[model samples]
Target: MTSVPRRTLNEAVTRFWSLAAPAYDFSALQRWAYRPPQDEVITLLRDHKCRRIVDVACGTGILADRIQRELKTEQVYGVDMSDGMLRQAMARSGDVQWLRAPAEKLPFDDGALDAVVTTSAFHFFDQAAALREFRRVLEPGGIAAVATLAPHQPPLLSRFIDSSRSLAHNPAPDEMRALFTDAGFEVADQHRVRRPLWTRMFTDRITVGVRSA
Candidate 1:
């Protein structure tokens, strides 16, 4: 597979989300489709006792703010490529240190984070590079959690979605697990999740991995 130029991908994604940032939190897609998995990812992070965590592609800082409050830590950070998104995120929490950065090039020291989580935005990432960055920043035994769109059922539909102009790649749960493994993480869990209403056409999944100590 050919790699997208990092600069081009960053520019395109940043432009798109920057324009959408103003109304992102109010969108039905955010409230209905993305919220459930975000809640789940938060629970997982809390369960694992992750106090120093960063939320990647953290649009409007919703998940990162929640993580900060729930975990009661000042170590929460939010990273996104869109300036508009970071601006909105900054308003959500004074505690969360919001940074404008891409998923593949996080601006942090290696092994500086206890956990890394990205929800509803992984499909827009260069999967391998993002995962490697996740692993690189996480301390040993730190967790990496991802929640993203599931591959459409019926191989044809999945292929169609992959080939769409959206520039997203929805991997099956197994493929996601494999990605974690290939990125040097120990695959800890994998499961499917769906929205309350559209349990069929739109689906999501969670994959958790642990860096070795």
Candidate 2:
């Protein structure tokens, strides 16, 4: 499939996060801003058997901390494009390895990871490029659990995001899944769970997939 224009998407993301960095922590506009439910999501990750997990687009290390607490893994790494966000994440949790990088380009060796998880940040990716990167870094049979809030559900969050002069765009699940398939992952499960309005903007669905051997 043809890819979206890189320069356009990069510029949009850069501007969006750059302006968002200062007030981002206090912004209720992010899909899920609360803490407890995020712990529940981490519990789900712990149930999986894989070790050596990588959290892509791991903004503020919400999921990373949970991984460190719940899972007995050899390594837990977090990667994001925004340095300011990474700084906040690093400050919050010093145990996990935080890297400043885009999801589309990972620095790890091929087939280095056992599992990959992301929460509420999939839509920002250039889907195809990010998935290809996931496929490249993930070992065969490695699982990827990606979570994103639905665009149609949360009116308040939607309104706030729409009002944000910097946020360029957001995509639906179908569009996101298509990119996953295009990158050669076989989707194994898709689940939707309702979260409190104060906790998150809308209900979140977690999609799990595996790279074929």
The best candidate in terms of lDDT: 1
User: TM-score of each candidate?
Assistant: 0.90, 0.80
Residues 136-200, candidate 1: write the lDDT tens digits: 99999999999887777456556745665546678888889889999999999888764576544
Residue pairs in candidate 1 whose N, alpha carbon or C atoms collide under 3 angstroms: none
Candidate 1 lDDT (Cα, 0 to 1): 0.85
The CA-based lDDT of model 2 is what? 0.72
> lDDT tens string, model 2, 39-140?
555766666677788888787776786787678566999988877678788888878999988888987999999888787677667667788889899999
Give candidate 2's TM-score: 0.80
**Best TM-score goes to which candidate?**
1
